[model samples]
Target: MFRTLVQNVPAVADTSDTSDTSDTADVAVIGGGMSGMATALRLQSAGLSTVVLEAHGHAGGCAGYYRKRGFSFDVGATTLVDFAPGGVGAELLDSVGIAPLNAQELTGYRAHLPDREVVLHRDQSAWHAERLRMLGDSERHRRFWALLDRLAQTFWQASRAGVRLPVRGPADALHDLRAVGLSGVPLARHLNRTLGDALRSHSLRDDAALVGLLGMLVEDTVHTGVDDAPLINAALGVTIRGAGLSRHVGGMHGFWRALVTHYRGLGGRLRVGCQVSQVVGGPGHYRLTTRHSTLHARRVVCALPAARTAAICAGLPVATRLQTFLERDAQALGGACVVFLGVPEEEVAAQELTHHQLLQAYDRPLGEGNNMFVSVSASGDTLSAPPGHRAVMISTHTELSGWAGLDPAAYEQRKKEIGERLVGYARRAYPALGERAVIAQTGTPRSYQRFGFRPDGAVGGPRQRLGNTNQHAVPHDLGGPGLWLVGDSTWPGLGTVACVLGSRIVAEGMLREKGFAR
Candidate 1:
């Protein structure tokens, strides 16, 4: 159900303004996140006139940033993965002659467990040694790693080839077949299986600690626990270090600014502080209703949450099946919370902490007071913090139901409690946290709603659980010709890498519709 926040939605009034012709475009992207920017740039590269509409003052969406006092903190995402040569971000940036930010290589995140502290390094050899030293080496562990390695490699290759999900046309279906080739046969074998099933197959299901760790790691990325995590994506989550992960020199916002700069340089028009209220259209064209103007476009790309997308599509000439699917996908998703902190440089230097860390508690649940993913900036990274200060971003998965149905006072109390609990966990993991803590703030799903423009301030896309993987994922096309989705809400799921990949798929779809591709 849509939140009752808006008591009455304004009806779309028919406008016959002749001056509105200036707002028309070959394609209109309905969100200015990384995905929307990528789609607009790619379309322009293909010789199509494109316009981008962003609700926020800037781009980046969930991967955006906020500045307070003299400190800069990430609004949502802290780290970026997939910086390799042929990666999605790499290719996209290269297309516009934009160089990526100077990123520090992340060996692996430090996981603070109940019995031991372990580091999962990017190098396979170092990771193996650390794993054996921490958790007694077992045949089950070896088998699971091997399987994930194979699946992850294949998944990367397929993603690089721009494999579209929930295929809508013959071109996409054929592309999927060609991209997978013979190697992806193994992935097909486990199409219906979950990570829990794989653990059982390897006789590792009895290892409670290992299962708990896997659940902790996956719940952040896949939006589901180990028992329900889809095997294909779970495999990628497990082997995340195999590819590469990095932190931008300034922050996430800097990276987004680079993309936006390159996009505008390529002649793409961006309209910030412009929110599309409804989209009503047919096959070849779309009429988008914004707060102050009614824009017309030959193609519409919605880079937003499923519920929000469904709300707009409800006013369109879309099929019943697609609208129903979007509504259901929205309800199936969870939420996320992030805590930002500013600490003095002296305390951070004394501890010599890594850029990223994952702290997990053995006795409690993952989000409440048990698990957190933390990212700290280098002491002298002036863009994030001054020379004498440091910036820290902490996040955890949360359910929307926990935040709903509360009075204003109760909601504020619950938010404070969660923020304090997360701070406590961070302090425990990094003892120097309290000593240098200068300023602190918390962002909830509602914060995300305000800044990221997602529904209920939800984080991530829908949960990619058992029945929500591969072809079962939400379709990029909501069963409407020339309409598409290109973000975490669609197939390929969440993360910066997935968003870029999904963007390319949507770009390809648009190009095909324009007869630019087969």
Candidate 2:
């Protein structure tokens, strides 16, 4: 069960005067997701006047929550890692004055295969040892762990350095040099020559168990195959071991609310239900024409997808290289998710199931409910469910184009069918799950598009390809002066850590441009 630490801090009454806009701020942040919120809060604390415009009524984007009949459900992410002490995510939260909660540490992740159940322990050494033991005395696990450990340490150093500096020209080159220096080799070469060759040569071809385990890891970490993903990015997951992945007390939305509270406290202004229509560069300033009114700022940070940026800045010098990168990166192949609520605690309690379970049906491929990751949040937690009822969230990846041409009626039907299939898979693990589900809802690529404001309902913006991957070519630079971009489309792809890290990079860039000390 998830728990919260109650701090008796008095609420700050809403002091925003929407009608008053005489002064232009240092920055105008478009989008109020975690990345946007992080940027606005940090810039405002640094004594820069900042305004955040959110198209949605709420702050969180995909990380938002929904409620139906006393049940609360997280729309996007359910589980998060690297939020422990000394971690970048934790440091970001603390820097904004949001107190961290004492979260319950999950013991292991259940991996269901055709013939056996694999419980991936939280401890790295123990998890590697168990895998070696399970594989019947194979030494491959030992070698894999050693390589993963080196990669993780190097990636951590890169993440730390990247979060602090601006990604431009020679500075970006130096950053890459520092990352390689720390890692002792180029990230791409290391992945292709080491991790890639090792897995292909030995395990993936022979061991079904190893393939299943690696499949789950790759799917969870990069939302893609091992060969297509960067080793540094993949290593982030390995290093996260023993860091105790935790869920927000109420739901992911509660975390968003907490962040908004912190943002407001830092004197950051947020305007909701406001959509940016155009971003025109004025002399030494940026004019953001919104659906309602126009605002001006010395800098404008667009925390949106590449397509959205293209839509707003229609007349800018349009970075052709960046545009090409966005086009190539637009492949959203991650699958859809089906969330169920109002599950009875007693049904799953007897099975010793807490809030999480992984379901695998031997009849399907790895991406098609062959393995389903399940999470449960207790009822009346004000975060996940109503009193006495539980919330279940399940996710799997699919090609973005799969749901492209369906009409509304067809879409709804598809969702129902998929939801039923997932519910059936869940039943194999917990027999009584179907009877306990009071509410069944499905989020397709179309739903993600409607809710997340993504062009193609790409859950994680722009897939990070292995080679020709320009880490600096990310659309963080807005193609002109006084404009920037943040969010998942930036350097690091997805996850809470990536969003926060992208925000820090944007803030640092803006600060340097404005002559602020590091």
Candidate 3:
């Protein structure tokens, strides 16, 4: 059922610069994911010599893609929202000369609960109006909308101020406080509430549909439930209410390719396939020991996870703290996703599927097969199938801790069973899915580990619960002078936009500290 693998670009040259030219670089960014790439690009554009060391051959990390036959599949992420003009995400893309496609805007998400199915529209008025009309007037719905609006406004303001910078000590904390103080009262109030209390106080506790909605939001944002998450992080998802969802025209991989192109064009150096073995430090500089050679730089940004950062900084003072943070703060939430491609054109014609769909079995446990988020890369006008064929990607949240240490045969059996069950559940929404699938690929936690290098195949990094939501909770400070951290495990947490924003903030802080500020 699979076709030939197509090469998109020529192999990158091995950059094993062993000569000690006495030339110093401004910064060296480890990990070539969106966060690392964005940071390197921003620094280089400021005229600072930057080098991005990516273990993988291509850039984009989780945001990258691979091609099979004629189809391009986004292996890591698929959906994006809040890309409107002037938004940080949009501005970043625009600066890189990557424009959003004029594709059809998704109305909203469709929820398939065990009891019923509901289609969520992008228009707030329309969405609320429909809910009230169908479920009757409930004070819960009214209060929910009001809270959503308030939270959305506050988050929009905060995001506009630019992502917060890394804080080193009490002095940095005071600076951050001053910045927040200048923003005024609303910001303070918004950060003071927990998402759980917000929902319970509004009488939304008994509403299954409302719970499902908030649950999905929580899952996508924190990789956990609302009760365990902080109000500030949850508010980030609520704030995306009316912003139209977007996707790259070809696939998400197209977006990654565009970023690499822009970065290379700016005269930035990118070394791929060279694994960094150790990061050693001298009197005032740091050197990266890779398989081929060593790269010495004045400043280094550890853009990978805290665990991997610990591995690289073996001889550094912060190594112990980094390891602790990785164990406690960087614990992974287990989950797996399966991508289905090559469904014939005729089957897609019968089932009118859109670019996205959400399937749920309400009675099931939260981490089980209860909720499944699906996205189709088909044409905009038609939801079910791509222009001539059909492509579907489905994902569910599972605890990686539960699957660890299992025997190889048992692990394979579990994957096969889960894959079949998920496909069966999807068949209920699109009956034609049964006989139409021509290519099926199952990605277990092992697959994620193999491809993304996530330790336990944890797609989401560190749970955004109450105690771990603060600035210090993030391993950004590293407790050392020159070492820094940036990624999904850092402040602001998961999602492509959040990761990029966090990385930018770290880069800006480093620039300011090094006297490169405007």
Candidate 4:
């Protein structure tokens, strides 16, 4: 069971004043998501005057959550991973003097593949047993697991030590080279390789069931099927149980509030409902135009998606090409469609369940109706559900363009149809979900655009394929003098862990530029 997220600390005074509309700071971070908050808080703690301008009413971005009819649903980010002691999340929380949230340890999720059902256990022995049972005790399976285990270990260890790809500048390049050491050498060979490459190497590429299973897992995590998912990231994605995945006690919304509390308690200024319209200055000195006022800062960290970032910097001459590149990348990313449900507890009393569940049907396309990642809150968790109800959040990838160019009525009808289809499919896993299961709400890419201010609700970061891995991925340093990008769209790619790591990378680069450390 997870610990309760209960931290009672005295509130720090709002040190930086925005009431006078001074609109000046040492550093200004755009988009108060996970990355933006981390960057601003770390810089403020480092003695830099920082302010966070977020378009949304709350922080957490994709990690935000909401309540409806007494049921709480996690909007996008459902779990906290890689948060064990000394892990990336742990280290970051430690630095901020904030304690880790109470989380329930996941014993791996149950994968309902097309042909078979398998429980991917967190424990090595259990996983080995399951692998042997489903994949058979063959040398190919052993070799594949061996390679993934090694690659995952190296990738995670390097991340824990503060090493990320897509070096920002000379200082970042130097830091990366040093962080690589000998452990990262093995990872280099797989930089350009994909899960398919490893499968082919083991002669298991033709195993339909194995390929289907991994494809489901990899596609959900890296936004690429096994055929194209880079080995380094896919390896980490497949073996994530070793790192740890947990559900926050009160849902992700609680986590967001906790993060905001910690940041504000540190006297860091956070201004929600402030949208950055444009970026109009150069390195060393930049001016950001918000809906209400214009703000200036010496350094800026942008945590918005590439499209939004590009729009914000459209006024800069050097950023024209950068904006174009970001636009292209944004178009290439997968869109998200989420469905929330509230079911009576008695409806599914006979079945066993995990905190997270993934099911994929191989016949359909990669996104669309082929796959779904679902999360269900434990019964009696009043924070997320009523006493006799269970809250469920389901999501899957969709083509961003599909939601565009539709009339308002058509869009609403399409959303309704998709929601019904998804709910019908979900009942396959939870058979009790008949009319008794209430369809609380459904959200599409358009919903994300309205709330997150993203162009297409583009999420899950960049696609981690053959040509987009490691050094080839979108960079943290945008080559602008004082401009830096953090979050899923760059460097370490997507996920909460990647965002935190990216923030650290940006923070370190900023400190170095300030002559804090090498």
Which 10-residue window of candidate 2 scores lowest in summed lDDT? Answer: 1-10
lDDT, each prediction: 0.74, 0.66, 0.66, 0.76
Q: What digit string (tens of lDDT, one per residue) describes model 4 on residues 1-518?
A: 00011121112212222343647888889987888888887888777888898876666688767666666677788888788788888878888788878677777777777778888887888987898799767987888888888888877888888986776468667776677667677568778788898899999998877888888778877888888888888988887777888787768766766777777777778876678888878766789887667888888898987767777787765366566556556545778888888888876554566444455566567776577877787656777778888778878888988988999899989898878777777766777663687646888888788776767667777677777657877777774557888887777877888888889988977787643332
Tens digits of per-residue lDDT, candidate 3, 191-269, equal 5567787888887766776676667767766777777767777867754546556666655655665676677777788
Cα deviation of 46, candidate 4, in Å: 2.1
Q: Give TM-scores for every candidate, taking all chains together and pairing residue i with residue i.
A: 0.91, 0.88, 0.88, 0.91
Candidate 4 error regions (>4 Å): 1-20, 168-174, 327-331, 348-352, 515-518
List candidate 3 segments past 4 Å from native. Answer: 1-24, 94-105, 131-136, 165-192, 239-241, 282-284, 330-332, 349-353, 357-359, 380-387, 479-481, 515-518
Q: What's the lDDT of the predicted structure labeled candidate 3? A: 0.66
Report how far off residue 398 is in candidate 3 (Å): 1.4
Worst 10 residues of 1 by lDDT: 5-14
Q: Pick the candidate with the highest lDDT.
A: 4
Residues 449-469 of candidate 2 have per-residue lDDT tens digits of: 766676777776655556423
Superposed model 1: Cα runs more than 4 Å off: 1-22, 351-353, 514-518
